[model samples]
Target: MKIGLFFGSFNPIHVGHLIIANHLVEHSDLDKVWFVVTPHNPFKKKSTLLDNYQRLEMVYRATKDYDKLSASDIEFNLPQPNYTINTLVHLEEKFPDYEFSLIMGEDNLKSFHKWKNNELIIENHEIFTYPRLSEGQVETQFDGHTKIHHVKAPIIELSSTFIRKSIKAGKNVKPMLPEHVWEYLSEMNFYK
Candidate 1:
C-alpha cells in the first residue's frame, strides 16, 4: 500500500485540508492519505496550537466518512517537537509493508530546505504538493534526489487559523468545517 502522509497541526480540520486529501487519493498514485496530526511542530509556536488530542479528534470527525482518508495520532507518543524525518523513519520501521510518501502544500515547499533532515526525507520518499493561496511563488528547484509532484487540488482560501480567529470573534463557521467537526466545536466552545 502506498500511503500519502499529510502532516499538519490540524488545530481544527477544515474544508481545505479535506479537499487536498481527497484530491491526492483520487489523482495521485497513492492508495490512501493519512492525516498525520502532529503533537508539536518544532518550527511553529506551541502556544498557538490547540491540545494534540483535540486536534486529532477534529481530524477524525472530519474524515471519518471518507474511505480513502484517515487520521493518525502517531506523533502524540513521539518525543516533543516532532520532526518529519524522525516520524518517517519510525513509520517505515513499524509499517514495513506500506510505502509512505509525503503530502505538503506549495507554501511549505518554499521552506523545505530549512526542515530537519530534509535531504533524508527526499531521498527516501516522494512528495505530493498542492498549491495554496500564498502571496509569493514557490521555488520548485529541488535537487536530483527530491521528487516533488504538483497536485492540482481545489485551492480553498480558508485555513485553520482563519477559522479559529472567526470563532473567537463569535462568527459562525458552519460552512468552513465539516458537520461533525462544527458540531463538536460549537458544543465545546473551542477557540472562544
Candidate 2:
C-alpha cells in the first residue's frame, strides 16, 4: 500500500484536518493517509498539548467514518523529541511492503531544510505538499524537485489553536470539529 504520513499533534482533531486528509487520499495517488499523532514535537511546548492518548482518541473519533483516513499512534512509543526521519525509518522497518510518503503544507516546506537529516528524507521518500496561507518562501532547492509534489488542495485557514481558544472562551466551536470529536470534547470538558 502507498501511504502518506500526515503527522501532527492533533491537539483536538478538527474538520480542517479531515478535509486535508480526505483531499489528499481522494485527489492523489496515496492509497491511505495516516494521521501520525505526535507524542511530543521538538518544536512545540509539551505543556500546551493535551495528553497524548486524549489527542489520539480525538483523532480516532474524527477519522472513524472515513475508510481512506485513519489515525496512527506510531510515534507514541518512539523516543521523545522524535523527528520525522526517525519515524520514517521505524515505519519502514515495520511495514516493509508498504511505501510511505509525507503529506505537509507549503508552510512547512519553507522550513523543511532545518529538519534533522532532511537530505536523507528527501532522497528516500516522496513529499506531497498542499497549499497554505503561510508566510516565507520555500527553499530554492525544492523548486522543481522531483521528490516533491505540490498538491492543489483547498486552502484551509482553520487551526486547532483557534478552536481551542474558542472553546475556552465559551464559544460554540462545534462546527469546527467532527460530531464525534465534539461529543468527546464536550463530555470530557477539554480545553474549557
Candidate 3:
C-alpha cells in the first residue's frame, strides 16, 4: 500500500486541504493520504498552534466521509517539536508493509535544507509537491535523484495562518474553511 503522508498543523481542517488530499489519491499512485496532524512543528511557534487534540478532531470531521482520506495522530505520541524524518521512521517501523511518501507544497521544498535529516528522508521516500502562491519552480526545474513530483490542484489562496488571524479579529472566514469545519469552530468557540 502506497500512503502519502500529508503533514500539517490543520488548526481547523478546511476545503483546500481536502482538495489536495483528494487530488493526490485520485491523480497519483498513492492509495491513501494520511493527514498527519502535527502536535508541534519544530519550525513553527508552539504558542500560535491550536491544541493537537482539537486540530486532530477537526481533521477527522473534515475527512470522515472520504474512505481514501484518513487522519493520523502519530505525531501526538512522538516527542515534542515533531520532525518529519522521525515521523517517517516511526511510520515505517509500525507499518512495514506500506510504502510512505511525502505530500507538501513547493515552497516547503525551498526550505528542505532546514528540516532535520531532510536529505535522509528524500533518499528514502518520494515527494509529491503541490503549488502554492509563494512557491517557486525550482523543485521541478532543478530536480535531483530524489523522486519529486509536481501536481496541479485548486489554488485556493488560503493558509492556516490567515484563517487564525481572521478568527482572532472576528473576521468572516466562511470561505477559508469547509461548512462543517466552520460549524464546528462556531460551536466550540475555537480561536476565541
Candidate 4:
C-alpha cells in the first residue's frame, strides 16, 4: 500500500491540516496518510513546542474520525532532533509492505536542501506540496524536488503558530482545530 507521511509538530491539530490530508487521500494515489508527530523538529524553535505526548493526543483527537488518517508516534521513540530521513528509514524497516511518501508546503522548498539526507528523500520518495504564504509573499517554489508536486486542497491560511499566538493572548482558538482537539487542548492547558 502507498501511504503519505505528513510530518509536523501539530502542537494542536487544525482544520487546515485536515484539509490537506483529505486532499491527498481523495485526489492522489495514496491510500492513507499518517500524521507523524515529531517530538523535536531539527529546524523549529524548541522553546515554543508543547509536550510531545500532548501534541500526539491532540493529533489523535483531531483525526480519530477519519479512517484514512492516523497519528504516528515513531519520532517519540527515536533519538532527538527528529530527522525525516531517520524516521523514513525506521518506518520502511517496520512496515516493509508499505511504500511511503512525504507531504509538505511549497514555501519551505529552499530549506529542503538543509534537511538531513534530503537528496535521498527527493530521489526515493514522492512529495506532495501545498502552497504557503511567507513574509507577505506567496511562495510556490518547488525547489529541486521534481518528484514534489502541489496538491489541490482549498487554500487554508490557518497555521499552528497563529493558533498558539491566539492561545497565549487569551483568545479563543477553538475555531481553528476540531471540536475534540479543542476540548483536549482546553482540558490540558496545552498552549498556556
Candidate 5:
C-alpha cells in the first residue's frame, strides 16, 4: 500500500486538514493518508498545545468516518520532540511491505533545511506538498528527493490556531470543525 503520512499537532482537527487529506487520496497516487498526530513538534510552542492524548482522540474522532483517512498516534510512544526521521524509520520497520511517503505543506518546505536529518528523509521517501495560502512559492529543490512534486490540494485558509482562539473567545466554530469534533470540544471545553 502507498501511504502518505500527514503529520501535525492536530490541536483540534479542523476542516482544512480534512479537505487536504481528502484531496490527496482522491487526486494523488496515494492509496491512503494517515494523520500522524505528533505529540510535540520541536519547532512549535508546547505551552499552546493541548495534551497529546486529547489531540490524538480529536484526530481519531474527526477521521473515524473516512475510510481512506485514519489517525495514527505513532509518535506518542517515540522519543520526545518527535523528529520526522525517527518516526519514518520506526514506521518503515513496522510496515515493511508498505511504501511510505511524507505529506506536508509548502510552508513547511521553506524550513526543511533546519529539520533533523532532513537529507535522510528526502533520500528515503517521496514527498507530496500541498500549497499553503500566503506562504508563497517554495523552492522544492533538494538533493536525492527528485520524486517530490506539488499537488493541487484545497488551499483553505483555516488553521488550528484560529479555531483554538475562536473557541477560547467563546465564538462558534461549528463550520470549521467536524460535527463530532465540535461536540467533543464543546463538551470537554478544550482550549478555554
Candidate 6:
C-alpha cells in the first residue's frame, strides 16, 4: 500500500486539513493518507499546542468516518523534538511492505533543503506537495524533481492559529473545524 504521511501538530484537526488529505488520496496514486499527529514540532512552540492526546482525539474524530483517512500516533512514542528522517526510518522497519510518501505544503517544500538528511529522504520517498499561500520560493534544485510531485489540491488558507485565536476571543469558528472536532473543543473549553 502506498500511504501518504500528512504530519501536523493538529492542535485541533480542522476541515481544511481534511480537505487536503481527502483531495490527495482521491486525486493522487496514494491508497490512504494518514494524519501523523506530532507530539511536538521542532519549528513550533510547544507551549501553544494543546495536549498531544487531546489533539490526537480530535484527529481521530475528524477522520473516523473516512475510510481512506486515519490518525497516527507513531511520533508520540518516538524521541521528543523528532525529525522526519528518524520517523521514516522507524516506519520502514515496522511496515516493510507499505510504501510511505510525504504530504507537505509548498511552504514546507521551500525549506526542505534544511531538513535533516534531506537528500536521503528525497532519494527514498516520493513527496506529494500541495499549494499553500506562504511567502518565499522553493529551492531551484527541487523544481521539476522526479521524486517530488506537485499535487493540484485546493489551496486552503485556513490555519489552526487563526481558529485558536478566534475561539479564545469567543468568536464562532465552528465552521473552520470538523463537526466532531468542534464539539470536542467546545466541550473541553480548549483555547478559551
Separate clash counts for every candidate? 0, 0, 0, 0, 0, 0
Give the TM-score (vs. native) of candidate 6. Answer: 0.95
lDDT of 1 by residue, 1-192 (tens): 999999888888998889889989999899999999977656676675888888888999999999999999988888876688989989999999999999988778768889999888888899998887764456655733348888888887888899999999999899999999999998888899
Better of 1 and 6 by TM-score: 6
C-alpha root-mean-square deviation, candidate 2: 1.7
Model 3 steric clash pairs: none
Q: How high is each candidate's TM-score?
A: 0.92, 0.95, 0.89, 0.88, 0.93, 0.95
**Which residue runs of candidate 4 sit more than 4 Å off their true CA positions?**
41-47, 135-146
Query: Which sequence of candidate numbers ranks them by lDDT, best first?
Result: 6, 2, 5, 1, 3, 4
**Candidate 3 local lDDT, 60-125, one digit each (tens):** 888888999989999888887667898999999999999999999888877887889977888899
**What C-alpha lDDT values do all the predictions have?**
0.87, 0.91, 0.85, 0.84, 0.88, 0.91
Q: Write the per-residue lDDT of candidate 4 for residues 50-152, one digit (tens) a residue.
A: 8888889889988999999999998898887667899999999999999999998776666777889988988889998776655333343444447877776
TM-score of 2: 0.95
Give the Å shift of residue 59 in candidate 2.
0.4
Q: What tens digits encode model 5's per-residue C-alpha lDDT throughout 1-192?
A: 999999988988999999999999999899999999988655676787888888888889999999999999988899776688999999999999999999988788778889999888887889999998888776644623577868988898998999988988989999999988999998898889
lDDT of 6 by residue, 112-185 (tens): 89999999999999999988767435565699999999888888889899998899899999889999998899
Among residues 3 or more apart in sequence or in different chains, the pairs in candidate 1 whose N, CA or C atoms overlap within 3 Å are none
Alpha-carbon RMSD, each predicted model: 2.1, 1.7, 2.3, 2.7, 2.1, 1.8
The candidate with the higher TM-score, 1 or 4, is 1
Candidate 4 lDDT for residue 76: 91
Off by over 4 Å in 1: 41-48, 143-146
**What's the CA RMSD of model 5 in angstroms?**
2.1
